[model samples]
Target chain A: MEYFFELLLSGLTRGSIYALIALGYTMVYGIIQLINFAHGEVYMIGAFTALIVASILTMLGWNEIAILFIASVVAVVYSMAYGYTLEKVAYKPLRHAPRLSALISAIGMSLFLQNYVLLAQTSDFMPFPSLIPDLEILEPIAHLITTPEIAIILTTAIVMVLLTFMIKFTRVGKAMRATSQDREMAMLVGVDVNRVISITFIVGSATAALGGVLIASHVGQINFYIGFIAGIKAFVAAVLGGIGSMPGAVLGSLVLGCAEAFFTGFVSSDYEDVFAFIILVVILIFRPAGILGRSDISKV
Target chain B: MLELKNIKTFYGNIQALKDVSIEISEGEIITLIGANGAGKSTTLMSICGIVPPRSGEILFMGKPIQDMAPNNIVSLGICQVPEGRRIFPFLTVAENLDMGAFLRKDKDEIKRDIEYIYELFPILAERRNQAGGTLSGGEQQMLAISRALMAKPRLLLMDEPSLGLAPLIVKQIFEIIKKINTENKTTIFLVEQNANMALKVAHRGYVMETGRVSMSDTAANLLANDEVRKAYLGI
Candidate 1:
């Protein structure tokens, strides 16, 4: 029972990170109907920026809180700028093109970014500074929520709440929902559709960068290839949660994280991906639209 | 006032509107009538810059706006209630209406317009919190028009507002259109297939066939013309 509780605690901690990253995928997909393949690179860029900024701040004798704040700000801004540039240069021109072309472009962009990062910052894994103090909340029964875990979960929950509020109560959020539903109608009603699309990318990438920083802080090391697996996992979480549903992504990430924990703990670490695939297949076979996904019937 | 002179619109290889020239004076309701695919909706779309004319001039209040973007056009006091009642399905009726006035900065005015929209379409007011997709066809149509009105546009362009509504509901919508015109003095350009009903409410009308403006006349005169009545009204 203690072991199970420990697994659940760790599962939730990792799930928080997945949820934050999945939000980036779900958000961009919701508004643009395009899978931003380069989103993972945004994560990688965030981790590297945080690493550089934290090291600089530490060298300058800054305290933990100040370094964390500066690192987060720089990482978020850099990621948002990268996301904006990616959309303007690659996705914007292919806005009306076939889905296959966009998907290919996204893959190409992912590869290019991976190589660019590899060339710029050596292929070695770099140790990241821990921002949160490792405070244990439970007695040594082999499992208790640590400070990083608590921080990840709380921060993700808060961000999700703020995002929900924005989407529900703000005018820009309404415009985003409008543009997603019917682009032409939104434009006719005086929505700057392009600007909304840009904002979606910016929001998605910024959150992804934050996720990168948090995950790096938790694990203590990151590399150029760090985003690849995390990105794929987050994409899976987004799909499992129903791609466009915000709450769905969170739930999906939790379920996925739990599944991975169980697989790693009981079966084997190498079999984690196999378990993920099997779960995805089984879930889709039983519920094709996903746990919370609604079937969309196209009307003329 | 809105004017389109020598406007030509094309969809790939097919031309949808050819040299379609017309004028809609402020404080008047103008209608364009045609058969299926006769460039009626295309005309309205061109005026709002949805489908820009290949070679022509479009003037809004004597200012050329042929190359303006859709949002910019709306900012210039032009808004559209497009065909098929394209209300955001996931949004509530209230949110859908809010999107219509997205460019406005005055909070009080937005609230007042929303209340007025509720008064105009009481059923929508009752369903303000319901998802737009759940509304009946006629109700959705009403919401669509009210959403456009939230923009407080100087010129409102409506396409096929009565396309799928019941006859009684169609009558109700036309009555509301007339009321809006007289009460707000909003210049309206209506594209419709219901020639008989459109002519009954419009001051002037244009007849389009096969991507060309086949005829143009005063609404009463067009209603009496043999060609329009036989081809469109089935009278």
Candidate 2:
């Protein structure tokens, strides 16, 4: 029972990170119907940006909490800038082009960003400073839950709740939903679809950056290639949840995370990636629209 | 308040509108009526900048608007209730209406306008909280029109508001269109395949065929024309 509980806690923490990254995938897909392959690179950039910030703050002798806050804020801002630039340079020009062409452009962007970062920073793994203070109050459940795990879960919950509120209550959020449904119709009714698309990239990138920062802190290390694997896993989660559905992304991530944790905990950890792919294939075969995705019928 | 001269539009190599010219004064209900593939929708789309004219000019309040973006044109006070009642399916009726007023910043005015919309279409008021996709065809059309009106547009462009509805619903929609034109004093540019309803309500009409306006006259004269009767009125 204790072992099961431990696995569940770890799964939730991992799932929270996946959910944050998956949201970027799901939202961009919802609005533009383009799978932004470079989104993973944005996450990678975020981790490195945080690392750089942490090093600077540590040199300045800042407290751990202040260092974490400043590092996260700077990382999120840098990632947002990268996301915006990526969209403008790589994706915007190809907006009206064929889907395959846009996809090729995205993959090209992914490679460009990876190489750029690799040349700028070292290709080797860098140690991520542990900034989350260990909470001694949870000593009773310390075996099952750690401070970092609690922080990851709480941050995800807060972000999700805030995101939901924004989507449901805000004007820009309404415009985004309207644009996703029908771009031309949204334009006819006065939505600047371009602006909405830009905002989507901004919000999505910020969340993904948050995930990158948190995951780096929890794992205590990151590399230039970390985003590629994490990005693919989150893409799997997004598709599992139903590509365009926000709640579906989170649900899918949790399910995938739990499956991964259990597979590694009970079975051979080496087969984790294999199990994740198998689950994706099986789910797609049965429910192509995903767990919560509605199969849309194109109206004549 | 709106003028188009020798406007031409194309979809790739296929020309959808050729030499289409129109002129409308403020507060007049001018309708473009035609059969399927006659470019009536294209004419409206051109004005909205969804499909910009490759040639000629469009002026709104005498300011050249052909080069503007769709949202910019909308912000200039022209709003479209598009064909097929393209209300956001996932949004509640109220949210759909709120989206229509997206560019407007005055909250109290928006609230009052929403109240006015409820008065205009009582059925929409009742289903305000329901998702727009679930509404009946007639109700959806009403919501589309209401959504456009929420923008407080000076010029309202309506495309096939009566499409896919029962005769009774069509009649109800036409009545509302007329009421909006007269009571609100809003200039309307309507496009419809249903010439019978469109001609009856509009002050003037243009007949389109094969991407060009074949005829233009006062509504009563167009309705009386033998060629229009044979081709469009099904007489």
Candidate 3:
């Protein structure tokens, strides 16, 4: 029973991180219908940005709280810039091209960013200092919960709430929804479709940056290759919930996270990834449209 | 008022509009009618800058607007209800309407326009919260027109507004189009395959054949012509 409770708690914490990253994937896909293959690298760039910012802040004698906030902001800004540049350089030219070509371009971008980072930074995993204090809560429940876990859950929830509000209430959000639903129609109505697309990338990249910072703070280290597996997991989560659905991404992440945690705790950690991939395949075969995706009838 | 002088449009190498010429005077409803590939939609699209003419000129209100972007064309008060009633399927009816006024900043006026549009298409008001994708064909057509009207365009371009509706629903749509033109005095450039319905509403009309203007005359004259009646109206 105790093991079960501990696994559940850990799963929820990890689920929160996956949810944060999955939001980026879902959002970019929502607006532009591009999978944004470079999103995972944006995640990696965020962590590196945080590392640099934290090191600089610490050298300047800043406190832990100050460093964490500043590092988060720096990561978000850097990742947003990277995402914007990626869209302008890679995705924009292929706007009217075949979907297969864009898919290949995205894969190429993923490889390019990973290799670029590998050359710039060390290929090996490096330690990232713990930015948040790890609080051992739930002593009565055998310390089933911790402050970092609470923080992760709270931060992810807060961001989700804010994002929902933005999408529902703001003008820009409406523009995004319009562009996503019908690009040519949106342009006819005077919504700058290109601007909305860029904003989508920026928002997705910024959220991904936050996820990177939070995960680094939680896990304590990262490598240039860290984004690949995590990116695949989040992509699965996005697909599970519905690629263009915000709430779906969060829901999918939670399910994947809990499943993986239970599998690792009871069955074996070695088979953790296999479980996720199997779930994805099964879901694809059974419910290809996803839990939240709308079924589109082919127009004759 | 709008004028297209020897305008040519192509879909890659295949010319869709070959030296097509027409004029629309202010507050008049002018229509282009023909068969499926008669280049009717191409003429409207070119005016809205979705498909710019390869050669020749389009003058809107006496200013050349041949190279403007689609959004810029809308901002200059030339708006289009594209073919297929291309409503944003995922958006709520109200949100879809709001998108029509995306370039405008007048909040009070926008609200007034929304209310007016609802009154014009009361079914749309009832379904304001519904996703656009779920609307019936007639309702979607209504929303497309209402969305275009939200722009308060000086010139309204409608492409195949009656393409896929029941005959009764088609009558209702044409009635509304007539009301919009007479009441609002907005210039209308309509592209349609329904020749009979179009000629009934248009002050002047053109018959397009194989990417060229086969005939241009008063709507009454075109309706009475033997060639137009046989080839287009199936009379």
Candidate 4:
């Protein structure tokens, strides 16, 4: 029973990170119908930025709490800039071009970012500072779950709630939903679609950066290549839930995380990555649109 | 008031509008009647800057706005109730109306306008919480037109409001269009393939064929013309 609970908590931690990253994929895909392959690099860059900032702060003898908070803010801000620029430089010009052209551009951009990071920084795994605080409240169950895992789960819940509220009630959020549903009609009704698209990229990057920082702290190490694997996994989670659905993305991530956790615990840890992909393959074959995805039935 | 001077619009190499010129007076309900693919929707889209005219100037209140964006055009008091009633499928009915007033910042005014919309279409008020896609065709059309009205547009352009609707619902929508114009003192540019209904509601009309404006006259006169009567009205 205790082992089952431990695996469940671990799965929750993994699911939280996947949910955060999956949101970026789902949102960008919802509005533009593009996969945004470079999104993974954004996450990796986020972790690197946080790592550098945290190191500098620590070297300067700053307090641990301040360092964590400041580093996260900087990472999010930097990633947002990268996401905005990525859209403008690569995707914006290709907005009117064929979809495949944009997809290729995204792939090229991912490669460019990876190589740029490798040349600038070491292509090595860096020890991530334990940024998430150790909470005394959960000391009794330390064996079952750590403070970082608790933080991950609680943070994801809060972010999800906040995001749902924004989409349900806020002006910009409604504009986003409106634009995604029918962009031309959104324009007809006075939505600045370009502005909306930019905002989506910014928001997606912000969440992915948060995910990057959290996952890095939890796992205790990160590298430039971390984003590649994490991003593909999150993409699978998003697709498993239904690519364009918000709750679907979160639900998909949880299901995927839990599935992998159980497979690793009872089956074999070596084939865990393989397990995630197998589920993806099975989902694609059985429910190609996704679990919560609506099949394409365009109204005429 | 709106004026289109030699508007030529294209979708890549395919020309959708060809040298179409039109003039809409400030307080008149004008209709553009045409067959399918005659570029009626393209004209409205061009005016809204969705598909900007390739070589023409659209003067909204005498300011050349051919190069503006679609949102800017709406901000300039032009709103389009496009073909197929393009409401946000997942948004609630009230939310759709809110999008119509996307540019307005006055909270109280927006609320009042929403109430006014509910008054205009009481059924929409009943379905305020329902997702737009779940509505029946007639209901969606009502929501679509009501959504445009939420913008309080000076010049309202509608494309095929009567399409794929029952005759009773079509009559109701036309009545609302007429009501909106006279009561709100709004200038309207209506595009429709339902020539008879359009002619009845319009003060003046233009006939478009194969992306060109072939004729223009008073709506009553066009309704009585032999060519229009045979080609369009099926009389």
Best by DockQ: 4
lDDT of 3 at A130: 90
Candidates, ranked, DockQ: 4, 1, 2, 3
Candidate 1 lDDT over residue span B53-73, tens digit each: 888999998999989998899
Query: How much lDDT does candidate 1 score?
Result: 0.88
Off by over 4 Å in 4: none
Give one digit per residue, the lDDT tens place, for model 2 in A1-300. Answer: 999999998999999999999999999999999999899999999999999999998999999999999999999999999999889998899998899998999999999889998899879999999989898897888888999899999999999999999988888899889999888989998888999999999999999999999999999999889989899899999999999999999999999999899999999899999999998898889998999888985653
- Of candidates 4 and 1, the better by DockQ: 4
Write down the TM-score of model 1's second chain.
0.98
TM-scores of chain A across the candidates, in order, are 0.95, 0.99, 0.96, 0.98
Chain A TM-score of candidate 3 vs. true chain A: 0.96
lDDT of 3 by residue, A59-178 (tens): 999999899999999899999999899999999999888988888899999999999999999798888989987654544543787777778889999999999999988999999888
Give the number of colliding residue pairs in candidate 2: 0
Q: Name the 10 consecutive residues with the lowest summed lDDT in model 3 chain A.
A: A133-142
Native-structure RMSD, model 3: 1.7
DockQ of every predicted complex = 0.85, 0.81, 0.77, 0.92
User: Whose DockQ is higher: candidate 2's or candidate 4's?
Assistant: 4
Candidate 4 per-residue lDDT, tens place, A12-102, comes to: 8899899999999999999999999999999999999999999999999998889989999999999999999999999999999999999
Deviation in Å, model 4, residue A128 alpha carbon: 1.4
Q: Quick one: best lDDT, which candidate? A: 4
Colliding residue pairs in candidate 2: none
